[model samples]
Target: MTTTPALLPPDIRVFERGWLSSNNVLCLGEQATVIDTGHVKHASETAHRVGAALRGQPLADIAHTHLHSDHCGGTAALQAAHPDARVWVPEPSLPHVQAWDEDRLTFGDTAQRCARFNAQHALVPGQSVRLGARDWQIHAAPGHDALAVLLFEPEHGLLISGDALWEHGVGVIFPQIDGSDDFDTFNDTLALIERLDPRVVIPGHGTPFGRADGGIEAAMARSRARIEQFKAQPAQHALYAAKVLIKYQMLDVEAMPHAEFQRWLDGTRTLHQLHQLHRPDLDWPAWLALVLAPLFGKGVLRRDETLVLDGA
Candidate 1:
């Protein structure tokens, strides 16, 4: 299939943003469109980066796989810069976005920040959108986020798997935390990705990779292991979720005082709910004080008397 060269199509380039934002896929041609706009905190940087990539080209449209804070946080800022740029989001998330409901959109619930933005159009499933000269097929992908979607370009065998199928493993099964059994659906999504047999995958968080079979197989195995582990010990998953959120915040802030970190964790309603369901035995202050231990011991984070640094 000569997958390598074709998979790295010049029209589709990935701007590899770090944690807290998904990679922005730049599809340039007659009308420029960007998939995912990074995080709101880095909106200005994202705009400048994309602008430079375009070389004076005006960004014309934006499409998101999901409404996760990181993926669409820069939408409002980007729209303000290019007021004519059309924004599209998953159809299911249209209402929450239109209402600017941070809670419903999960920013507020998770204690994360996302600039409010309006999506003028919906990224409807079973339809194709023009990203440059090619038509990218949109398919409903519900695993990490119930409403996430995957964009596939058949001719090129390129897939924008979003967080549904990352290079390493799928994103957190957030539906579980929200009291939904989504492991089966997640498995189905992975199977679908495997069936499509993409030559290259531009995932939501990591660098793009080629030859999906090995990665997909490895990721599927890892996912099955994790799912089985979670099924047996749900609390472990809860704790993992808590740590992920903390690490995400630390990635954005780089560092924070212990008091502020504690407060942030305390205020994160989603984490709190996970804790309540799985670790309710401990009181707030006690759990708060001990919760960072595992992450610290694993070298995922570093903590001093008053400060928590990013993997310090």
Candidate 2:
């Protein structure tokens, strides 16, 4: 595994990994806390690394910005290793954690994506928690997920923004993609983050970045541009869907046959494109024509008068 350099001052350490996992932060003080553990696949390694960083300081708490599998996957392992550690999670997600809903939590489908963890305390917005000697403020950030929240240290001007914000974009505006997302809610949440005016941001997935030198503004601009582009072209949504599937499946496009690809799409919600385009009444041929025609014309998919993998 490639190692990410320590980005924060001596007090804070970051364990940066790839997309399947989030960067973990170790906040050292009288009471040490870890923010957002990596996915379950990497939980053991993450714990080891975090243990080394603690250097005998008890890991007093394990906190999460949201309930996403990747962000809290390692919580169980870390807590198990450090039996005295208290696990903190957003108040809205507390019920989900208590019930441990495998299906509702989407854990059954993404087991490889996250590790299981137990919640010991609920962290609410406007609430304050003492980490070391400093008090960190919790703010509700509900765009990425309705339960998502962020951490802000007013004195340090540092923000631990989970999937709510990223260097290039935000988390999959899940509600939008799932056809149940509320754009208005997402916009309101974005505005809330903008108002925070954080000097430094430690996102859920990327390297720690500064608000200075136009970093935050640039990221916000990129997010706005993506929102506009997505609104203009619905197919961009499908493209992202495919990208996510590829990442989740870890499939090599070159090795997949056209028939297999079609089966995969059929089994997944991609088949719902017919409903999305308001052509639900169309027959299979008509639906295939409606769906594949534009993609072929756009050179995204190639068909030699037969459903063969492009370039095959």
Candidate 3:
């Protein structure tokens, strides 16, 4: 958790994490709470980071913005670190979470990893949750993931927007994979953010921004263009999703030998799905090389004969 202290409330700090994990928001007050603990691989680091940031203040609560692997991967570690702290997750997925149903929870089918964790409470939309000594209105944001929520504080004009609205654009419209056609909902969620008119935005992935209105506008433009492109060619979106998932895995490992990397990349069911959806004619290696060309071309990754390194 890299400390980002300026342009935010003294009580609220954004722990900027690498791309593989979501940024954690640490809220300090009479009852201290940390929102969104990054990817599972970094669970121990995240727990230690929270401990160092707490400065002996007992953590009283842990909450999630969503249940994506990157968003809630450190839940178990944090719970272990502060056993007395209550855990709250998005309400829609609580049943699946309680049962640890990997498919419904999106770990199995996606080949993503999330350490099992328990949720004692629910973060229901339309409710005001008290965290970091401020009342946050929990608004249902159903674009990135159906159960995702956005938190806003009217008094401070601060918004804790999850993946639904990033500074650059929204995340993949994952519901489309199930043929749910959630692009409209994603657009609606963007409209909701625009309406919030937040002065500052602490997004799920990047650093907090002060002039969020302009960010919102820029994000909306990108969202609309991407959605139109995705709508026109759904298979392209699937290929993009495959790349993102692959990149996320690469981030988790940092670097991997070619043989192990190929095995891991081939292991993802989502990537296989994309292969079947878009390029059944090409073999896995050929298909992967084609899809990964963009990443390599952009210098975000480096591929050699023996190993692959995440350059970005």
Top model by TM-score, which number? 1
The digit string of per-residue lDDT tens for model 1 on 1-312 reads 012244477877788887788888888898899999989889998888778878988888899998888899888888888888888899888888888888888888889888888787888899998876678999998878888999999998889988887767546778878876546777778878888888888888877777744765666577777777877887877777777888888888888998898788878888778778667999877776577777888888998788889983
> Residue by residue across 59-125, what tens digits does model 3's lDDT show?
9989998888999999899999899998888898889999999988878867788999998889989
Which has the better lDDT: candidate 1, or candidate 3? Answer: 3
TM-score of each: 0.91, 0.79, 0.90
lDDT of 2 by residue, 1-312 (tens): 322434355777777877767888788888898988877777888899889888877899888887766777788889888999988888877777878876556554332345556786989899988765468899988767777888988887878888877888755665565566555566676687789888888888877777767887888777767766666765565455444543443322333456775665565553354235335467755665665665557654554544444331
For model 2, the local distance difference test gives 0.70
* Ranking, lDDT, top scorer first: 3, 1, 2
Q: List all candidate RMSDs to the true structure.
A: 3.0, 5.2, 2.4
Question: Number of the top candidate by lDDT?
Answer: 3
Residue 101 in model 3: shift from native, Å?
1.3
Query: Candidate 2: worst 10 consecutive residues by lDDT?
Result: 246-255
For each candidate in the order shown, give its overall lDDT on alpha carbons: 0.82, 0.70, 0.84
